[model samples]
Target: MSKQSASKSNIPLNPLAFIRKYDELWRRMLFLIGALIVYRLGSHIPVPGMNPERLAQFFDGSQNTFLGMFNMFSGGALERMSIMALGIMPYISASIVVQMMSTVVPSLEALKKEGETGRRTLNKYTRQGTLALAFVQAVGMSAGLISGGLTLTSGLGFYIPAVTSLVAGAMFLMWLGEQITERGIGNGISMLIFASIVSSAPGMITQAFTDNLNLIVILLFAVLGLAVTAAIVYIERAQRRVPVNYAQKQQEGRKVYAQQQSHLPLKLNMAGVIPAIFASSLLLLPATMGQWAGTSANPTTLQSIAQNISLVLQPGSPLYLLLFAVFIIFFCYFYTALMFNPSEVAENLKRSGAYIPGIRPGQQTKRYLDFVLNRLTFIGAIYMTIICLMPMVIQTSFGVSFQLGGASLLIMVVVLMDFIAQVQAHLMTHQYHDQTLIKSSK
Candidate 1:
């Protein structure tokens, strides 16, 4: 056999071997776990000056609304009015705004093209935006609590301290997420969100059981959950492979090489779970406003407006579902466009002496890629809409209190897949390194 075949055969198949050889990977994994633990612990630390009973009552009333959804994402932090009540949402909101702005604002767009330096600048802006948004949200939350008589004191002193605590909590969580990204495995923000969802699972399940849901209904939901999970795994793995052929080339000191063939694999759902999250956040806005307005003691024009919106945008409402579907589709395409630039991919392929079979090397290839991506994205959007909306339909129809809904399930499954992929990548790199060293020593 050839040396290549021998080296390939020698690659370690046991995970234990990779672990024994790569201490750094283990350290990174540990660091990620530690960071997530810190986040989970912080989620239980209540903010100062809140009356727990009243706060719990408020959350109970809003439990079926968008606030409940927000609370779920925060791992019940909002329900407890915890220090991490804001969660990582403000950061996500800021990111969405900055990404959208980068498209419309010339300076931001230019910065997007500036590579690492531009990326750093954009990150700085996003951090600043996060702080500002957190502060504003904290203030609003404090005011809402005070208005709802959920605060211990009714004075300026209470507002000042409570808002500060909440804002600081959010900023700290943001810092933790950044640290995780820099020092650990996978996407930190996504991992934190994933952790939140998973951590809340037991409580949600227990709640479902206590709600007196029929055993058969519960069993059915479990079956549906498994089915949805299987579907998600299949869809997430689906990709459209575009064939490329690299022309033969020769180095001045080496023999000419034969033409190489490769394929660019574009995921069916390029946006992943992001569009669903963005859409949920957007839909929750009106619901939040409605909650705050309708909860006031006296009825006002704003309260009436909020009530009307609340009625129209309830979870299972036709209008709510329609708007949700629209937002998901918009963000799926918008985020896909932001993340994968066909022109840039085409340029890189051209520079690397690669061309798609039966297509020209540059603009034509870009157009073709765009066409394919658009079609795939449309299908993906439909898939996401169905997956996300299915839970609401189930809850409405079955009156079941099951919490493992589509968005939660999607986030959990996708993040787990991503985590496994990262570990596999690290293991592969370690194996390759080992193989290279063996070859060099020989």
Candidate 2:
């Protein structure tokens, strides 16, 4: 054999190493795929008393803008008024509420400090809140459907059974999401959302092609989406590291003691997509009110006020985008405040005998942290605002109804990259010995 080929052959083909790497590479993926299948199955199980024909016609002429697009992110389940129609929104809402409540509610606050045991307690409460919210939402939807005459039109005996079915269906989806998280690769909740985004993709593609959309326009959409996805990946991984100098130490017993110099990695966007989500959910309240009763979607008020709110809440309206950007910015700061505490950090540093250079021990360190955090947050909030609003502005300017799928695509790409990165990390570490073997043979 040639020298190079002989060297390659001498490298170990170790079964144990190969199996470990292979398992690391594929196990999570297997879980994710399996969970996604279950989520899709749940999406199609229709809520009782939903009029398929009416639902179809409503969607056919609808604006399909902000709120409608959000619904699509939950899959057609929202339109179908299926049980999972509520999707993960309620769970997310309950989680936010519980977390917020934990701060205000002393009992809950105590539980939060209990570590693993406290976490389990919080999880239990979150689940309870999810179920309660689902039941209420399902009832509201049931009443809305029946009052709108959508249920009775199908003549299938609507009211009581429909509410029951819808609630049960939503709960089923919740269970499915939890199962996926337990046994899947990606976050189970995120996978459910991801499934919704993907389910809508093929339809959008078909619509674009069959409608004879401008090729340049379609290409622009693709390129913009790719760019946004790349940007999201970059921003998600971005962090500001603050250096810490530990107090120098001498030998103790048989071991040499040395200073540990390190830095804290504070993520640029510590709150992740959570703030955007919370803001969006809160904004939907007005639309839900309008849907509940309407001459205008807003509550009956002074003519100008009602008109103004209706205009603002309208999908793709300038007012809606404005409100969305403001809300995202607000929530970004709010969530950031909730997530990080300068005082706590300073206290930890004091306990650990570490200090930032040129900073005093306690209050000064806290002040410095707050100053740095505020600056980072300013940049982060602006970045978030631009990302959230850019797609809306583009679609509106171009008169393109379907382009904002780019935002959803961006989220999916980032999330998928995170999952892939975790897998690759496991594989690389597991294959280190194999690489060493190959190197030595050379």
Candidate 3:
């Protein structure tokens, strides 16, 4: 027993040793958790017009509609009408506009290739754009208040106060997101969306339960969700490793053809959830009009217009299903084009003395890479479109509503998954260092 105890003691007691016997995931987990907490807290904080008693009545009197869903993505701040109610949406809008402009505006296109300084300049412009958009939307909301989104007991006095408060809140929220990006683990804006989704999960589950879904159906979706998540994980990790060969160097008049190996790894879903996000953001214009039509137009005319919009553009509606599919496909290609250039890649590879096996270098190699990417992108587009659109379409078809958002929920999930993998990679490297030091000490 004494011998056994001694052996056990010698086996190493620090569990971190066993895990750091390769990777330390705890530190990264801690940072991610801490950042998420800050975002979640902000979501519940209320805005200026939050009439305590009336707030519940307002939500109870009406279904939490799409804006309610938007509020959910904002972590309930929208309902409370908090400073963060506008969330970081204005920034996302600004980014989209800037990204599109960078491709079209000749001067902006030149600036893109100028490296870090140009990037910094673009960043400044993006910030300017964010502020501009926030201000405009703030005024719009203020006007909406005057037009009756809110009741002004003080008449014209309300406009100045409301707009000021709202705009200030938006800028504050923007600051918060920037802080998270600087100090937090995952992308700050993405983590905000993650917090919102997580905050709302319990309510959604309880609602489903109370709706009296059959035990089997409840269990089925639960299992299905798990399965789908696992599939996403697998697909995201899948990579096509194209082998590259490098010729050997000659020294002192002796030539040795040395073969080196590297892989041009192409991810199965390379464009990522960005395609879905872009598509969803574009679709929101029509959807926003539908919302406005609901609130402002004459009842009958509103009904017809809303129906028409829904038919053509609403998520899960028939025309919506068609357009959504096409949009996913289009943006998959479009964003891929924006971010990557096979010709540039081939040029760089040739300069570096790397060549794919059985492939000619330069433009020919570029063409081959392009061909491969097209097929991979098609698979990715199909997978994304199906996973994202299915839940909403099926639910809408069955007269059951669920919160299935392309930009908010699905994108958050995918981004979070990627973030976790990156964290784990860092942890693994740290553990490897610790292990090497330990071995040297022993």
Best by lDDT: 1
- The TM-score of predicted model 1 comes to 0.93
What is each predicted model's overall lDDT from 0 to 1?
0.87, 0.72, 0.68
Q: Where's the lowest-lDDT run of ten residues in candidate 2?
A: 289-298
Sorting all predicted structures by TM-score, with the top scorer first, yields 1, 2, 3
What is the alpha-carbon lDDT of model 3 when measured against the actual structure? 0.68
Model 3 agreement with the true structure over 1-442: per-residue lDDT tens digits: 4775554554444675566543335654565677667666755665454345544555543333545555566666766666666677777777788888999999898889999988877878888888898787666544433333443243556656656766676666666666666665667667666677777777777877787777877786777677677777788788888788886767678866677888988887888877776666566544543553444334466546764674455455677667778888887887887777899999999998899989999988999999998998889888888877776665675555456443344676687886877777776777676666555445
Which parts of model 1 are misplaced by more than 4 Å?
1-20, 250-255
**Candidate 2, 1-442: lDDT as tens digits:** 5897675655457565456657744766777777677777877788766778877665565435333665666777776666677777777778878988988999998998898999889989988998898777766656556545555343346656776776676677677778766665656676677788788777767776777778998898778877887788888889999999999766666675778889989988877776666766666645643453333223345534534564568666877778888887887787888789899899999998999999998999999999999988888888878877787778777777663443466457656876687667766776786787677666
Of candidates 3 and 2, the better by lDDT: 2
Candidate 3: stretches off by over 4 Å: 1-34, 50-64, 145-149, 152-156, 252-257, 289-314, 405-409, 432-442
* TM-score-best of 1 and 3: 1
Please tell me which model should have the higher TM-score, number 1 or number 2: 1
lDDT of 1: 0.87
Candidate 1 vs candidate 3: the lDDT winner is 1
| Global Cα lDDT for candidate 2 | 0.72
Local error of candidate 1 at residue 68 (angstroms): 1.5
Predicted candidate 1 versus true structure: per-residue lDDT over 162-202, tens digit per residue: 88889999999899989988899988888999998888888
